[model samples]
Target: MRILYFAWLRERIGISSEEVETAAPTPAALVEELRAREPRYAAAFADTKAVRVAVDQEMRGWDADLAGAREVAFFPPMTGG
Candidate 1:
């Protein structure tokens, strides 16, 4: 799976994206897997409430299924100025 991090998430994780091999069934599960990887990932995902997710470029909730997802993006909510 391809994971993309944006905004502060990328800054905290120290990477823009990565190709991961995971058997996670949901975005929430994927988060737990990533959080277990390292301190950076743990920190980045520490507060999921501040983040939003997208599966295959479509916005999705944390519990959303990831069965056929090829790409997942994590980013903070946008603000209109």
Candidate 2:
């Protein structure tokens, strides 16, 4: 699956996006796999509540299923003026 990071998430992870191979069933599970890879990934996913997720470009929760999904994106919550 392709994972995308935005805003400070991109800066923290040091990449905008990357293709990941995992056996995760849910978004939260995927995050756990990523957080185990390195300290950078750990830091990037440290706070789940502060982060927002999307499955195949549609916003969803961390518990969302990843089955047959092509893309997953992580970003901070948006604020409008």
Candidate 3:
């Protein structure tokens, strides 16, 4: 799956996006997989509460299923002034 990072997530992870190969069933599981990969990933996902997820461009919960999905994006929650 293609994983995308936005805002500070991109800054912390040092990349905008990347293709990841994983058997993770949910976004939460994917996060665990990434967090275990390296320090950068761990730091980037250290506070999941500050993050939001989108699966295939649709906003979803951390437990959202990833079956047959092509994209998963992580970003800070949006704010408007």
Winning model by TM-score: 3
lDDT per residue for candidate 3 within 59-79, as digits (tens), equals: 999999999999999999999
Candidate lDDT values, in order? 0.97, 0.94, 0.98
Rank order (by TM-score, best first):
3, 1, 2
Q: Where does candidate 1 stray beyond 4 Å?
A: none
Alpha-carbon deviation at 39 in model 2, angstroms: 0.3
Q: What is the Cα-based lDDT of residue 23 in candidate 3?
A: 98
> Distance from true position, residue 68, model 3, in Å?
0.3
Q: Write the per-residue lDDT of candidate 1 for residues 15-81, one digit (tens) a residue.
A: 9999999999999999999999999999999999999999999999999999989999999999998
Model 3 ranges with Cα > 4 A deviation: none
Residue 47 lDDT, candidate 1, scale 0-100: 97
Write down the lDDT that model 3 would get: 0.98
lDDT of 2 by residue, 1-81 (tens): 999999999999999999999889999999999999999999999998999999999999889989999999999999999
Query: Top lDDT: which candidate number?
Result: 3
Q: Candidate 2: minimum summed lDDT over ten consecutive residues — where?
A: 57-66
**Model 3 worst lDDT run, 10 consecutive residues:** 12-21
lDDT of 1 at 27: 96
